[model samples]
Target: MTKPTSETPAEDGAALLDDVERFHRRFNVFPHEAAYVAVALWDAHAHLLDCFDSTPRIAFLSPEPGSGKSRALEVVETLVPRPMLAVNARAAALFRSVSDPAGRPTILYDEIDTVFGPKAGDNEELRGFLNAGHRRSGVTYRCIGDGGNQTVQEFPSYSAVAVAGLGSLPDTILTRSVIIRMRRRARNEKVEPFRARVHEQQGNALRERLATWAKSVQDRVAGAWPEMPDGVTDRPADVWEPLLAVADAIGGDWPQRAREACVTLVKAAQVNDKGSLGIRLLTDLRDHVMVGIDRLPTVAILDRLNALDDAPWADLNGRPLDARRLSRMLGEYVTADGQPIASRNIKTAGSVLKGFYTEDLWDAWARYCPPPSASPLLPLPDGADTD
Candidate 1:
């Protein structure tokens, strides 16, 4: 089987993505989040037996229970390659499984929060394996036999992983994953119940088709380099590359949906987990913007952030954060990598002084911060370029 071409119209590819979206719709997930998860699964099934440098982990996180996290994993178990529902797998057994010369199985890990939560110390070795297995060259060494006669055994640790649980994953795992934040179904929204006997057959059919498609396009995906959107870079780029390639190869609305999902979900993860104190302050400042003013002086911004009872800004190094400290912390946002995110400039109200435009803060929030709790902020009106 060869790669899909323009003349082919990608009927098989389109059908595959259609099944993926239907699979996603079977659960209660937010907007494009399900699309992202679906594409990640396609990438996962295709990823094994092929050499993609970074095999992204699909991380499903929810703030509370009964949010369909495990159910989503169950659906994934029926779809991916040789799925292993290893909810409580030991570190040794997991690495050993990956080392098997036959082939690596897609490890579907549920209730993963417990493994990486407050008692993470007990599972340090497991954490190490999860972190190391993101890239193609991942490996672990073990020793066997008596001390004097011991020999080191090399274990290939690269494999596709999907983890689902409550709360956040560790920073290491979080950075190396496409994080999907799951939410409980709303009163109005509903989905069909997942019955094993019925859904299993449906899921299995999709699985066989996916396996065939992946085999057909393995060479194409192996050499693919899908174009990334703005705001995607570095580790985020690495993790999403394979999913995007799979999307392009599928050749339909999937290509477009995949990019949208990539930008939206990756931004959410960056806001929620990966950021310096400065970026976080920018996120917090969104709540302080005034309608008419459209700007805030450094002093005013600091005061508002410090006054928040839940915020830690008031007692930074035993003193309230001041203008100088805030400026120093936020200096990078002004000209990061030759691109400005936000800036301090003159705002005249009978007196000229340095302040940040509310517009800049809004733009930064949309680009860098997590999604707002209530609703997504409307796009900036035309001609409000902060950069």
Candidate 2:
């Protein structure tokens, strides 16, 4: 999404209500996911007129084909101001535009991998732009002008971004994006109708409302910062800085909830990337920890964890269930409060594991593996082999 430079912090906002509410209502948008979109597109709206400053870029990805990624983008297209639909542009032209620091409108790309089709690393140029869009420092490049002049210009960078595609994007992009994983609706489930004109009217109203709100609370947005969330320890400043700013601006339960949601969702996606954990990861981790493992040998404990048909040990780490990751994941399963693993934390761990087990992955463990009791973290008793 592209933002114009004319917007001011104190400018009156007349857009949020219609755009945010409409998008929220029309689709079964996930709360965390919807917030990301709202904020990014909100920046786009501000840029269009003259309100707030930069914002995070958005990406919407899904596990497989037919996960409604394009449909999600349809909603974004209406809400975001001056969105650049990448798939519609010719690849060479798009890269050239992006290469120029002044690439305008929001750069919206669809079927990105496919769009960069049939060429040797054809998409590298485009990727560079998307990578930079997330951070001001990240958005710089040198392009030879029409007169064959070489100029190094830093492109305008803002949090205004959104992309949707199958599964996860590349790490360079993923690190910078607030991703929304699109889901496939079951045969029995459905959301209300959102045709083009209807979506447009609804989105326009939202934009107007949010813009109005921001105008009214411009001071609050700049000063109403809230308490920072815990466990943002390992996150990047680029990722958290704007996020915290948004929270500070909102200054209510939303600030805390939004930040926590970002941490949880981002981490879950990372864990899911590793392919080691699953819904079973949460259920099994709880089962194993509760059952106890103080006296159980590492091998026996491994056996039990692998035994869950719901959670496969081999899939945990493509190579094997190594001691390090296993121990780390177990340790991370609980928070400082020692509560059962929250669903979101489990998601983050699973995402992280998915990244590791990407290639040459072994199939899941055989069914009905045993559960473990408490342990003293003992070594294997004899020559007990895990494989």
Candidate 3:
């Protein structure tokens, strides 16, 4: 209940974000501090969407119902500008909503798993819409009218979008998102009951404050090239850039906090990544199945991979990874000299057989996988140097 005395815009911005974070913590139990940080930044970012080149989708996903996924989106609804909450909305409707002339809306899509789930059976248009919307220049083309009058017209798909659902989304969408893996609240964990009639006003008040702050810093945010934490490059850099920029603009502990959240969440995503089976295979080969050996015959590799209790090699497509499949998968990768890591005939004992030399895989392993560390999968602790 204490009033904030800071008069400067930057100080006010930082204080406002802190208020947003606390509001979320009141009704929701995020898995980690990073999730809370990312979500708060995302809410503020939505008000300044035009100042950003890309808007990372904040996804709240859970493996089961009642994991607070929808509740997370509900909390988001109150904080963003022009919030449009949709469930089971058609692709065309979404397309029009984003392209509306008044202003692009912040899309809070719940039950997203249904649109991308097994039973959904390839909602390609919706997928494309979500993917394209990540970048500022993203757009969707549509044929207008009929017959001779028909012509393809481009509709702007760029907007701030957050989704919540049970299970996972497609890899394309997941890569563009700040994923929060929601979980069932523990017995000891308790949160205030959310009744929109009472709390919506509170959230909306915060939303207005955020909108004013965003206006005050719009130009600065638009031109910001915030320094990224070491090892955060490529797609992860692109994903965290805007949030980091917003943090920098707010000017407080937020800049440091945002980077920590970026590293922690990015590391968590890498650890739990289910998208790249090929990269997984390469890392497994380097760490587990093909260690300290110069050569491993295809049969031996297959046996080891299949024997792995935690790997998918044993039941890939209802059959263990065979020599042919192994060769096919490995052939997809190249060495430092730009040669495929394909099997070569190796003379073992008296017989020759197709196998991979460890030297051939060295380049691919180095480039594609993180170096072996004692706890590579663990999240970086707060204030830990990522360099």
Candidate 4:
């Protein structure tokens, strides 16, 4: 391990983060440069978790097995503080471990899909733990003792958590995470074989250095309000704040690199988001189907939505989206004045029909959908002319 020779904390911090990034690069074939930056910053952030009010869980997710998801968690385990790698762990055991007086452990949860996947029956207890743990004061109330002697107790659940799994997580957990979509290495993307015996010591050395660097900048990180890139706001802002704070403290190409990663990954997640079918419907209506139209009758709206080859509206629940489904889905959203946007009677060419007025949808569009510029994340529905 090379010692940081710089006299200033910023200089030393930059050098240390660079070393961490390079170390991860040698072993992990990340999907993009942003993934490397995020992982490295996240590793450093774990050391300074107490400085921030909320800790974002870093998730390495893949669509199938053997995509290096577990390997990514393994690499992270060596670098975080008091790492507790949990697989098939009971909810009781996890919350107990987190609330231990020794200190909160950095949780590296592998095979997390099994706890949230189709075969995984309602594991609501574990789900609640993961959700509540994102904020500093988050906790779970548990009953302890035997029989009538049992009493309710609050267990602190806040901790730096990283999870790896075969598929996506629930929307609640996903919104609070820094998501890394991992893929299997191709023939030419060579990486050093990560054997625990040979490489764990090297990683541990880096971890120690990271801890020292984190201590040096703990105060600065605590007070940092790192500026976010354009279009990165709301939940995305919360998720990237800690990683951006770490980059700002380090002070190098990192600040620039970190923002770039923020934009790239946030956009990727929005484009590939599988949660909220209703949001998807709203975005589609605002961006693709309803373009340049003031009022669309229910029949016209259904035709446009169902025509989209890539959208799920055409085959939702084994049937195409109908008038009732459309109204129900749209009714789920409200206007700025807090009234639900519902279908109304539209008099079209002397014929009255049930449809939606563009005026009613404007507020929901502004509040729920990303601006039109970001709409390209999802391609225009199949063969529909945009011009």
TM per prediction: 0.70, 0.57, 0.89, 0.85
Candidate order by lDDT, highest to lowest?
3, 4, 1, 2
Q: Which pairs clash inside model 3?
A: none
C-alpha lDDT score of every prediction, in listed order: 0.73, 0.50, 0.88, 0.88
TM-score of structure candidate 1: 0.70
Cα-based lDDT at residue 213, candidate 4? 80
Give the range of the ten consecutive residues with the poorest summed lDDT in model 2: 357-366
| RMSD per model, one decimal | 8.0, 12.1, 6.0, 5.2
Tell me the tens digit of each residue's lDDT in model 4 across 260-281: 9999999899877755888889
Q: Positional deviation of 294 in candidate 2, in angstroms?
A: 22
Top of the candidates by lDDT: 3
- Which candidate achieves the best TM-score against the true structure? 3
lDDT of 2 by residue, 226-265 (tens): 4445655433334555555544454445455566666676
List clash counts for every candidate, in order: 0, 73, 0, 0
What tens digits encode model 3's per-residue C-alpha lDDT throughout 295-344? 88889998899899889999986898899888899899997689988999
Candidate 1, residues 76-175: lDDT per residue as tens digits? 7777877888877887999999887787888989999778775654577888888778877888788978979999987888888889988887777888
Error of 3 at 308 (Å): 0.9
**Where does candidate 3 have its weakest 10-residue lDDT segment?**
375-384
